[model samples]
Target: MGSVQHLPYSVSNHCPLLVNKESNRSSLRDQRFYFEAWWTLDDSFEGTLTDIWESSSAPLVEKLKIVQIGLKKWARDLKFNKGDKKRRLTKELEILLMDDMDEETLKIHLNIEIDKDEVYWEQRARTNWL
Candidate 1:
């Protein structure tokens, strides 16, 4: 502790840098299931909901738990399935673009893929929709 030098930065500065980095990274992901209003467009989704709502003989609370479990499973499954489909379509687009093809047909497929991408995003951004 003999010499005192004028330093450009302090330990405090680096501390906040480390703190900010840790604070910005979340360890837990959101796991709650949210019902997609858009799923009603699927003919089978309504029927499945009705079945889950009616098939349980348990009282109100228990019935609700069952339906919640069913829907959670359904939504989780849909998430995985749709995620895979989207990835597949994205890869397909990449591959298609790399090769030569008829412009008219490629445009049609591109439009379809774009629509799928939109729907995929719509499902994920439910909170922002409200």
Candidate 2:
């Protein structure tokens, strides 16, 4: 007999999945800074965050705003230097290709960055990874 294939979205455990959706119906709200998961990857992410939080003598809300400002600047600077490592790897690959040297490591690094970029854009586009 041919093996059974599970259909897409089929659940084997016979349990229905319940998803809770957040509604944005609150028309009146206090302004707040939005933090993103990618911000944690920034250089000095933890240090800057801790420094701003610790040094702030303002109210909690003001401290939050200060931290947000610091993080925004840090993220901006990080953005400018983004892809430096990948660019370096690409340059090395070019040299290797020219000299016909081993490029396995460079190719691996490029592949990893490509994967990261793919995921980054996919999340940005709100596409399902599955």
Candidate 3:
């Protein structure tokens, strides 16, 4: 059983219609891997990379495939909500500034800004590539 609905124009100009079916949705495994810029901000990313590289003794292409699989798992475990984190950090910074300066808040705010820069550059690079 399946259903279809017309999605909002704001959803995407290219994909304004939604096809609802158990099999209509593409499996995540079918998707290509693209390394995200903000992934470097995660503490576990380095460990995941090191583990993947060390554990894989296969040839270059096979090793790359392993890396891709490992990274996808890492991404799943990340559970990062960038938008919510940014909003929370921004609010915390505002509150801290209202009373007195806080070093920790400043540090967190700076880190988020760097993450935003990474995303911006990544998008720009993708657009240029296209």
Clashes of 2: 0
Q: In candidate 3, residue 59 scores what lDDT?
A: 98
Scored by TM-score, the top model is 3
Two-way TM-score contest, 1 vs 3, winner: 3
Q: Please, what are the lDDT tens digits per residue for candidate 3 over residues 1-130?
A: 5668877676456757788776533565368687777677766789889999899799999999999999988876554565666667777777877878765956676686667667758775786675
Q: After superposition, how far is residue 36 of candidate 1 from its true place, in Å?
A: 2.0
As a whole number from 0 to 100, the lDDT of residue 102 in candidate 2 is 86
Residues 8-119 of candidate 1: C-alpha lDDT, one tens digit per residue:
5565654322123243223333444456664554446788899999998999999988888888777667656765655675667677777855456546545654565576
RMSD of each: 12.6, 15.0, 11.8
> Which consecutive 10 residues in model 1 have the weakest lDDT in total?
16-25
Taking the tens digit of each residue's C-alpha lDDT, what string does model 2 give over 63-105?
8888888877776676676689679878999999999998998
